[model samples]
Target: MSENMEKTIGEVGRVDWSHFSLADFLELRWRLLHDWQAVLPGGEYFGQARIGDVCYDIQIEWLADDELAVTMSPFFPHDGDSAEPPYDELVSGMPYDTQHGASLISSRRSFLELTYESFIDLAEHSILETVARFPHLQSAASKQTGFWDRHDAILCKIREQDDEDR
Candidate 1:
């Protein structure tokens, strides 16, 4: 799909959960962690729209079942893996705690909405490489950082807000 179509799909936000569910999302996370092409091995998924770059896959690891992980991709680095540091190092490098950094990286949410929303756009923009260059981040910096110390609390608030909006 073209970038315009991708954006349209995102705007629609009409997901077919039957074909794609939370379990599938989790599995995708695991597969992409090791291989970018896990979703389309042999590049035979022609019927499925290309979501992101095939060069690299961004692995999203959720430490807890209640959290979210953000993986980026469109263009990936040529190295065996991205040069970016691990989530722990990135959190340690931050001035605040891990939770704070997680929020910052996640745009103030415990989880990010990347795969289902902008996957097609990512490929069209050819920015998957940029996404892959970043590390697979987790929400480890809970309430200690001054934002919401309780990761659960933050997640609850976000979920509530989403529900209200809906």
Candidate 2:
């Protein structure tokens, strides 16, 4: 019934798998590490969406035996400097413009009982919303759709590796 749910159904042929489902859960975990190419890299995953001078830092918090929470923060570079924010500054939950020296806009959304496919769709939808407001993000928007697409490697890795310890 939610917007995310609508986006996830059969999008790229993936069902909105539950986090509580063991079989689907492990597959989701491995698929994340494989698609993002961050295999077995601790608990949290960090990624970014760059739209010209602004970069949206995306962090996925993997909760044990449960759901995943994704947080995104937008950061602006000063005078063409493209450096990422200090590690501590990531996920500040504040969107700021370094050139202006002040936080400007903020937006947040929450989805209860999150699903792997819904998260993907929600993330893409969030990014697309941001892109609509920020003209600079339009150019990079084309490259971001791939992130939501179904990845065959998810099943492949689950088949090849043992997740008993995980």
Candidate 3:
């Protein structure tokens, strides 16, 4: 895990997006998705986790050359259908419930843009914030506990490496 953490941090640190090209952003996105999968077991780009009986799908989208979005919403398990719920429905009122056995009781989405010297700065801050808020989520009976724990541990290791470098 530490080796993967080092590799992820190294890749993030090596990103030179001063030019802010689309290709650069794509590469960063790929690396981030890869790192998330590698560090968080069973975690995928658009994976699902459960809390009690409800299940939520995690979605990642490249909104623009400089922005990325991560969303979590209630979703029915694979039932031979590949259609996603309407965007409006997902982002609507809280605890959005659907007849498809999925309910967005506590869904959330975050958008991050490249507005710093290194994209890692934003990514690191986001991870830290997520980590700090994990306890609250868990207390609220969120099923994303495992994913958040792994994600936080990896980021902490990366931050430690950064500190050692200084």
Candidate 4:
């Protein structure tokens, strides 16, 4: 996580969500997604994260003008092993079989609709909550094989380059 994000997490309640613009919210979203991708493997994006026994699938869609919908669903790992489905498959809702008779069952109550500003608030709160509840997500992710680290690292480097260019 970046220093700014850490600071934001520390002072979550004090931040004014209403003052954030769409671009600011998107930057925060990018950082949050990057951290999630770092911890979860097998997706082109940060769509899933596993904490202990339950895996969470995150989906976000732009609704209108500054409004966005975020859905987070927790499911037992597919076949009791994998925590993620492919990005394309997830977007398309493609069917695939799992092993050991396990299945994916999503609850309908895990949806939230908010403006981009409120979404940013949720993002900050979630970052703190994830760290508090699942401290090992990042450490465990370090031990797993995934492309997120490399991908995020490249993004970081590019951002650094852009900063230098400016």
lDDT tens readout by residue for model 1, 1-166: 5565455445322222233345555555444445533333222111111222112223343424443334332221122243544332112222211111212113214233456445444432433222222342111111113221233255567778889999
- lDDT by residue for model 4 (1-166), tens: 6565565344322322332356644643664445433422322223444333333445544334433334444333123244755222221222222222221221212222345656555654563454344323323322323333344356568778889999
lDDT of 2 by residue, 64-132 (tens): 334444445554422224464433322223223432221122221243345545655565455545544
Give the winner by TM-score.
2
Residue 38's lDDT within candidate 3 is 38
Question: For model 2, which pairs clash?
Answer: none
RMSD of each: 19.1, 12.6, 17.9, 13.8
Ranking by lDDT: 2, 4, 3, 1
TM-score for all predictions? Answer: 0.22, 0.32, 0.23, 0.28
lDDT of 3 by residue, 44-132 (tens): 34344444222344445444443445544433222223254333322212222223322222111222334323433454433323322
As a whole number from 0 to 100, the lDDT of residue 112 in candidate 2 is 33
Model 3 C-alpha lDDT versus the unseen true structure:
0.37
**What lDDT does the true structure give each of the candidates?**
0.32, 0.39, 0.37, 0.39
The segments of candidate 1 whose C-alpha lies over 4 angstroms from its true place after superposition are: 1-23, 26-54, 61-68, 73-111, 114-117, 123-166
**Clash counts for the predictions, in order:** 10, 0, 0, 0
User: What's model 4's overall lDDT?
Assistant: 0.39
TM-score of 3: 0.23
Candidate 2 off by > 4 Å: 1-44, 48-55, 60-69, 74-112, 139-166
User: After TM-score superposition, what is the CA distance of residue 16 in candidate 3 from its true location, in Å?
Assistant: 37
